[model samples]
Target: MNSRYLTPLTIMSLAWLSACTPTRVSNQVSIDSPAQWQHAANAQSAETADLKTWWQGFNDPLLNELIDKALAANHDLKIATARVREANAMVTGAEAALYPSLDFSLSGGREKRIDRIVGVPSGQGIKLITPTADAVSGGLAARWEIDLFGGRHLEAEAAAAQAEGSQEGLHAAQVGLLAQVATNYLELRGVQQRTGILQRNIELQRERLRTLQVFLKAGLANEADMVRQQTLLQSTEATLPVLTNAKQNLIHRLGVLLGEPPENLENRLAGVGPLPKATPTMPNLLPSDLLVQRPDLRLAQSEVSAAAASLGSARADLYPKLVVSASGGVGALAVGGFPSLAESVYALGSGLSAPIFNAGRIRAHIAAADARLDQVAANYELTFLLALEDVENAFVAHRSARDRFSQLTEAEGSAEKAYRLVDAMYQRGAGDYLVVLDAQRSKLAVSDERAKAETAVSVAMVSLYRAFGGGWTIHSGIDKASIR
Candidate 1:
């Protein structure tokens, strides 16, 4: 029998004929993690993040609209979604490699010249060859490569892993985009609040200037005092334009985030709004949960899986490749002065190819694939470490900001009380206008700090939510399988 007719059992039994790598691929890779988070001090609450629109906890309707628009229209996210579709197609193509392929062809041609012939006809005079001949032929061919080592199946698995990784990458992008939007929105609000504080303080300083002018007229104030109050009033007014410019720039950033032109969102967000109020602590965040909650980590792990399956596919290349092909056709030749006969033709074949020697090229391929697996495994481990660091940093920073905000809020209240008392004393002629002016400045400074601290806490919370990799769960249909 021809060597091509050898069955897989015979081939494996004759392993001394060629090199064979181990066919078994293990799915085991270890990552050690802690049981609980170390920075869960202020986050003692049991409230979990609302997986279905985590931003809604802010209770800002415009924020909700912006997030919805970003998810629907963000161009980077749309490109990531397209990558997922491409991965899905690759999986289908890999699966197609396991099945037989059929193709068809047809041809017709005319030949005008006939060469001199010397052969005699059987039991008759020599027959004259035709000067013009018409020929027609049609054929059907089928080919199949028998995957004796499951290489094609492993390639399909790798494609599926790539598809899963693409999905996690999309989710991570959504998480990042949400975090950016939240940060910009809260900052815009904070700048507006500070600008408002400055405007109000400017008005108070102007009133004090008016009072100073009356004092000068009554021989109780000097020219220096009137000029001093005027200077303070104008100085306080100077900061508003800078703050207003920053706020408008933040609005433009938000407009682009929502996939709109910069000029389109000014009217809608023109009115100043208060900063987002900090909500109760999100619950159920632990170190071990980061493995599942972080989409970037999930993507890294999926990439590792793909690399492993691809390594298996490359290893399979060390063995023989077997292919079977067959073709069948009908042909007819017609001469202008003679009858012609139609004939049936057929052919069958099988091919077995093994890399006998190629200067270790196949081995190099397997080595390269194994190296990729190692690279992805390292990346997966680093991603886990980064995930832990992100959650811990967010927790500590948020708790510190929350605590600091509380202290500044108390200070703001005290400062406001002092300002009111000084104003009352000035009205009854018991306090100097300079004293009232100093008290007002103190109050404004504390109020601005408090607003900034509030915005910081809000932004910190957004960072924590982003670290927790809350699922968007928007299935593009092909991403049904959970990441392994």
Candidate 2:
């Protein structure tokens, strides 16, 4: 190579490279964290509860078992896990760009040709001759595209960040799945409790109907009274089917969540059980904790990082690329009636390619990457705001549910007492059927409300823990004591 011809081109390439030095794109977003939660009053007890195992506080073995089954088998969680693995593989591929690649090849061929001899010795005229040739070749070639502007490194960084985001996505899926299973389970138990209340009310109403028949035989009660009592009993009976259907639906949903057929758990969960008890207790938590605990927020943060790195990688496209390649091999060839000839072949070369004109394609890509960076940053901020909303709403909902349940409990007891007293009076011919019916209706209504309220409290707690991102631990291991 002539120095004179290469000197100017090398200088120009260096100048371009100097101007294209890759810069790091920052993905940091501004977020103000509150020092304390707004609904701190709802959680008066300061005892640190391990949010990771918060469901254990319910003290229901069946509930814990269901959650375990869902975690092990849920389809959504498996999908998230696969995504994480894919992202990790992408990271590996991107990093591989930082190194060189080598390849080996071998080839062989034979050719034959027939020719007529125009001039022949010893008066031999137009003699025909056949000629054949053989060739063999083999080589090893290597190529490397040097990361002069750190473009490949940026790509690897982006891939790593995406892998992290996918991991957080898996965690988010786990958290949501656990919450769903717990919510449905609590609802199922609540329906069962309400059903039991209706059954008891029916029994009481049937006894009153028997007393009325006795009164009618003695000329104290009329056919209209008997008809009214029968109507109340039938109305209570009608409600049972609705509750039965609801319970069955919930069981089906739970079974699917656990990766089983819809009807698989019917026998297992058919027996009625008491609803999980609510403690209404939570550890002291601050808004800042969400940054570390909440998977969605973490996922958003990772997205911002990935977007920023992608922007940097795209910007590297504006610069020049340098590729170096080398090949070494041996070749052998032989002609008909001639000795074989063999030679060693080798080559070393390098090239520099700078983007000159592509109809603004590179610039468009850079602009798109910049736009994505901005989008992810904004999404990160929005995610934090939504996390705050979720926590605040869960706090209020859990507290309100607990309060409503307490009030309903007292009302149910009073209604039951009233119903018993009115029934006693009517049996003694001191009260009418209307009074008994009113008391019976009130008792059933209050009892049902209390059961639903109790379930609400449990479900609210589930929502609160989910908002806190409690059900998942980092694959690298998390500090359980600190996260509590």
Candidate 3:
């Protein structure tokens, strides 16, 4: 049989053998288990519409801009993108294993030598000079590892799956950055609003203290009353600096997220208004959507797929590997004064290698692959369950904060009216200073609570978006643009 035919024949036999026993495990887990996500009767129905551009629903231009900046420049996100690129390169390398590798070389050299005859009696004691000789050679060589055992295919598949997982990991990183930016921005604004409220209340308390001092001098109020009012005013004034400092810290964090110096944002945001209001209604993302939307969960799924492919590759290693090799070359040479001679040569070869003994290493590899696959399978399920829990928790938080915000809004209105009424009554000496002070404290408390509630709602919405895996998709048909 021709040597060239051996590789193909061996590959065919190995492929036939592999097909005889399809190596696989039946314990692969499903992407989602319906039993785990049973819906409650009173559960708010999640939106069925795809939330591809969920961030736009917030309707805040500043938030939209911040998210864009973070996606473009966040350090962790860039690292994740690099990982995806690396994975893609690995896939290309793995695929190259399936095709023949060809190389070519060309060379030319010249050499001169003085000939000395020692054995020839006639040439003894005589020095002979030889003309310089030149030679040229060229050759092409080819090698191919025939994937008779499906090892190369499995490797390529695993690499491709890993590439996909890396892409999803980038998406996950982006989603996380978006959530952080949104949450921080909301917090900054919340702190700003509270600071503004505190400042105003401090000014009001100062005015009240002045009034009390004046009344004390006029014998309308005692010195003890004046001191009590002064103490209350000082307490309110003390909180202003702490809240201001916290707001500045958040601004610095936002600056880092935007990939700029922290001090740079201070000037731009010096006169900026408070954080934008919360969206009117929170997004309702269903549990089922988490599977398709969340990048982390998708990444976990890809890992499971890669692990399965690895198991295939390990099983393939138990079979023989077939290889085909070919080489062709031409050379020229000169001897003494004779005419130059030229020769050409060509050759083809094939090989088969099987692991007959390795102390059960092959079996151990298969078992290890299987164990890894099992681990990823469990991780995938856990990721899904965690995502569901996040959604549930976000839903509960959003609803609770919304309800609390409504109550605080009402309480703030009532407190404002009560403060006005109490102030009027105190001026007419019909109400005590204690009533005025109590009303002022109530108003400040209600204002602070309302601000907190607003921030809570915004943060909860961000959590929901994250749990649903929002902001990684583009409407464009190109798949690369869809990845972060």
Candidate 4:
């Protein structure tokens, strides 16, 4: 406790104590976010979404099942999981470098020699020496570098941050995979519905063609009417193949998403199901909610932490390093039919390596690390801004799509009523055949638009969920050890 008794070694130890402790990495960063969404006009509910199973809100059991399957079997998710494991391994290895390492080694040698000088006995060597000998040795060695400047600690810190980033990456992948599966499934259903609508119209036209043919035979209608009806039927039939092809592609894509072969679902999904309905109200989230919810943003922030730790490590390189090493072993030399006493050997040493003149290599490394930190900082900010933009964009798209779907549905209903009235008038000879055909066309077009609009509404909802970084897998346990 006496100040006068402080030694140079004590002062150096104090310096090491201050310098070797790694600075902590912040797990969260601050970003400016809007309090409310840009397009909130048509939103039915202000409630926050249940992002973990947002697809279930559509009330489609099949959709929910598909999302579950994708989460379990998706190849991209598997890859992300593997990366997380790899990062975890790296973290452990980096940390291990901060502690002492022990190694084992063994060596043995045997040799025989005969004296060629003329003597009383040809096989005899020098009288005082052995003609053959064998020696053996083994030992445990240890080496430790004292982290006087926090170099090893910072390396471990950087690796730890990277591991956390990989965990976030895995979550990000889950979010993307679920959203993709849901969107593709919705589009497939939409296409199927459109195909059904076209088929119904084609059948109606075929029946009209038959009636027109009878009228021509009875000399009441011209052959031109039957030909026109036939042409309409053929054109409508032609569109069926396109829709079928699109459906097939979607099925194949979905199969791949679920980690199955493309043709694996050909027999199972033969029938079309109704397109998923959008939830009437979705929970709105705050801007700050995105920072915690969006895995990409979290991953980006982790990258910043890693880069900062790396800079710390690089700066530490400019300081001196202390290495402690020790080794000990026992060995015996054996002569022909005899043995020498075993000798014990041991060594312990401590050394310091200070960067004297390295042609600015260490400085360059420090500069590079600084640049990397700056890059990641910029990237983190970019990611935050992009996340906000994503939410706003998805909100606008979702609202607009809902609006469009509503308008299209109303238009389709009106067109269908008009078609029915025109058909009745035509049957009574009060309206021209042209009027009926025109009304039929209008109804078909409106119906097709309505189906597409429905698909858009659902897809936009998926986008909104994805933008919010809302994906919950059983693997996303709250335990930090689980993530590692």
| Candidate 4 per-residue C-alpha lDDT over 170-231 given as tens digits, one digit per residue, 9 for 90 to 100 | 98888889888888888898998998888877876776787788879989889877787888
Q: Can you tell me which runs of candidate 4 are displaced by over 4 Å?
A: 1-19, 22-30, 41-49, 113-130, 215-231, 278-281, 335-339, 423-441, 473-484
| TM-score, cand. 1 vs. native | 0.87
Worst 10 residues of 2 by lDDT: 475-484
Q: Candidate 2: misplaced stretches above 4 Å? A: 1-21, 42-49, 113-130, 278-280, 416-441, 475-484
lDDT values for all models = 0.80, 0.83, 0.77, 0.79
RMSD of 4: 5.2
In TM-score terms, which candidate is top? 1
lDDT of 1 at 44: 30
Model 2 TM-score, 2 decimals: 0.87
Clashing pairs in 1: 47-283
Give me the candidate number with maximum lDDT. Answer: 2
Off by over 4 Å in 3: 1-28, 35-50, 110-134, 278-281, 424-438, 474-484
lDDT of 3 at 477: 21
lDDT of 2 by residue, 1-484 (tens): 8987785587457545634446568777777766677886633323223677778888889988999889889999989999999999999999898788999999999988555223333456554555578999999999878777868888888999999999999989988898899989999999989889888878878877888899999998999989988898899789889999999999999988999897778988988899876453464566777877888988988898899989988888888888878999999998766689999999988899999899999899999999999999889888988999999999899989989999999998999899999999999999987688779878888988999999898899889988888876645522223221
lDDT of 1 by residue, 377-465 (tens): 88988888888898889889898999999999999999999999999999999998779878988998899899889988988888888
Worst 10 residues of 1 by lDDT: 475-484
